[model samples]
Target chain A: MPLWDALSNAMRMTRKRRIGPDQAERLLATGHDPAHPELDRLLAAATAPPRPHELAGLDAALAAFEEAGRTRRPAPARQRWRVLRPLAAAAATAAVLVGGVAVAAEIGYLPGTDRPAAHEQLGSRAAPPSTAESGHGTASAPAGTVEPTHSLPVTPGGTAIERLCRGWDDRRHKGRPMKPDDLRELAAAAGGEDRIAAFCAPRLRPPGNGQAPPNSPPSATHPSPTLADDGDDDDQGEDGDEQAAARNKKKKKEDE
Target chain B: MDDEELAGALADAVRGDSAAFASLWRAQQPALLRYLRVIVGESAEDVASETWLQTARALRGFTGTPTGFRVWLFTIARNRAIDERRKARRRPEEPRDLTERELPGSHPDVANEVIQRSETDWALSVIATLPKDQAEAVTLRVVAGLDVAQTAQVLGKRPGAVRIAAMRGLRRLAEHDEVRARRAESMPPIDLQSPRTEGV
Candidate 1:
């Protein structure tokens, strides 16, 4: 039994050591071994030429290939459009937001331009007392413009004088009677009610004579003469007035 | 196919040229079918067809050399074969007897073709008798003509393990009873230096 076990162990070791990676590579590559012709035959049989049944599915495979090509050809372009759609929408939204803020700032609708609200209120009061008392067209204009004045120091004296001049000119042109409240404010500003026309004569000249028309309504572009003279009252207000004046000058040049 | 021919065909195929794709199919289908025969048995043709369809769908996105393409192709076939086996296991139908399987022949020289086909079938049947890893390693290395590293990539095994499996598989084929009987018949009757004398 001991001798038989030794023989079997030796045989197993020899079998294990005989075939390795290098020998397998050689046998697979050349297949011309004189010592192992059976292995050569086995390899030859395994790698025989293609049988007829192997290529039978060519038509089906090609059809599938053509189908895949047809379906996938337009995918990249559609994918690109899909990826860019959101970016385009975001760009358009950003443009609208920026443009809206700029228009609001130009029209004195934004915060920190509290002087426009004060002027707007005085202009409402300076309308003909019958129109102002009735609470019609000019009364509603300053309602949206009144919220910002509470945060600012009151400076309605100059704006009131400009509004009275505009109201007096408008009444004279329309051949309408003057409102008593407006006449009282004009009397105070001109030192008397009879001198109201003289006080407004130089102030109401048509634009382009270094004096804008007082017949024109009080808007962001037309700062009251007293406000321009008393510039130290509000620095931001003066800057806004100057910018509006510069823009108007440029617009006038373009129009000419 | 050679590298240059394969590169050109792959480029044109990616551009949706049917003729170039057909060339690629012709070059790869034989080895793919033989490998599938070893792995999936009678369903080799079906699995190969599925593999080609999948390859066609993903061909545009595949970027690699010819060798890499071969590796990718075999990887797809292996995955499909695994799926087929899983499906077969779930169904659990009666296994087909190997002796009853028919060998197809379309050539005019009928007798010679039958003999050769039977030999090929016999060899493949013997290989199929090996353990799964050994059988796959041998089929990929010898029949599909892939290098050890490429076979490892397809089989998802280490190169050393694939090499060892292939070596053992070949050794087992060499030591099979039928192979030894055939070797004895082909040898001179009075030979004394036979290696079998020591082991047997």
Candidate 2:
């Protein structure tokens, strides 16, 4: 069979111990295969240098690679923001919880508002000396300082809802409805005080647009807050005279 | 590039300097393209482009000397060629006409015609006829000018395996009548129409 002949030929080829690559290369350079001199011709032919034309298209290829590299260099900053935005939002939510919610909201530090615009509105009146004015000092100041120009952290609605629910908890404990405020308005929009918790839960877990409830009218200070109109004089009702004076100062600025 | 120039360019390239990258590309692209041609045939240009693009993107992160860069570049190119082959297998294209066969001793003046056919083309054609592993071994060793260890690194094989493959491939090329016919001045001319003992 042809298989037997092939096996015999392979055996014969192997019988003359196979030429090492190094030895073959050496023979190739010399232009003579010591064992099979005839093969020297083939080795010499195969070893000929490639033509200059072989290097064609190289310049254009490198140009294309450089073009791609230029475009890809700026991508890391955008990628980093994609990872950090949510962590910032979560940190803001946790920070709002520790600070007194009613005082924070009364100073126009409520959530569901454009942060920079709210900071802009709050900027006109000097920030209150009270360290418990946590909403403006802790939440808005850092965001303003870090990314003062970029309109990135527009999701103050979660903070607004947290402030509202805290107010609802206070009203339930005191057995009295605190004078009409943003929390009261948000609760009313949710249909009742009982529904305030449910209403705030989804808003706290902000969706993509970061807007408050669609039906709630935009407030004077923050374009997104639906409860701006309800909390006008409630600062005095909740925090007595001094906080009310500060709220009056804020209201004057919003009106102007 | 000499080792000093290559090392400096490699260091600059790792720092994302485009000029350094271009210098490295100019020095290495010829061999890389030739090696790709041997393996991927017509699509070598596209595959080489993909390989360089990936290399450029990852240039900043690579940490090695110039010689290591060659191994890494070829490894990426070989992987890309393998992927192209697999894709081609899945969606088969119309077969090209292969009717024009080169008969042994067909040329009247063998030595002249051998010189006319550039060695790269002739050698690649012979290599294409070889088994895949042997062809890769020979192309990486001879065309790419990689040492045994570097060729083994590129091929993802043991150095011994790479050596054996290159040895077998060179032996086969030596035995091939077409290759031997090119060195007509040193040996008696072969008659393709008749069979005779392969006289050394």
The best candidate in terms of lDDT: 1
RMSD of each: 30.7, 22.7
lDDT of 1 by residue, A38-115 (tens): 676667777777667566789988998998787675455335434654564454356455565445423423343222
Candidate 2 residue pairs in backbone clash: A111-A156, A111-A160, A112-A156, A112-A157
Over B20-128, each residue of candidate 2 has an lDDT whose tens digit, in order, gives: 8887887677667767777877677777877776677567768896778787888778766765665666676845221122222555766654543444355567766
Q: For model 1 chain A, give the 10-residue run with minimal summed lDDT.
A: A247-256
Share of native interface contacts recovered by each model? 0.45, 0.19
DockQ metric for all predictions: 0.16, 0.10
What is the TM-score of each candidate's chain B when compared with the real chain B? 0.87, 0.79
TM-score of 2: 0.50
lDDT of each: 0.65, 0.55
TM-score leader: 1
TM-scores of chain A in all candidate models: 0.27, 0.25
Worst-scoring 10-residue span by lDDT in model 2 chain B: B191-200
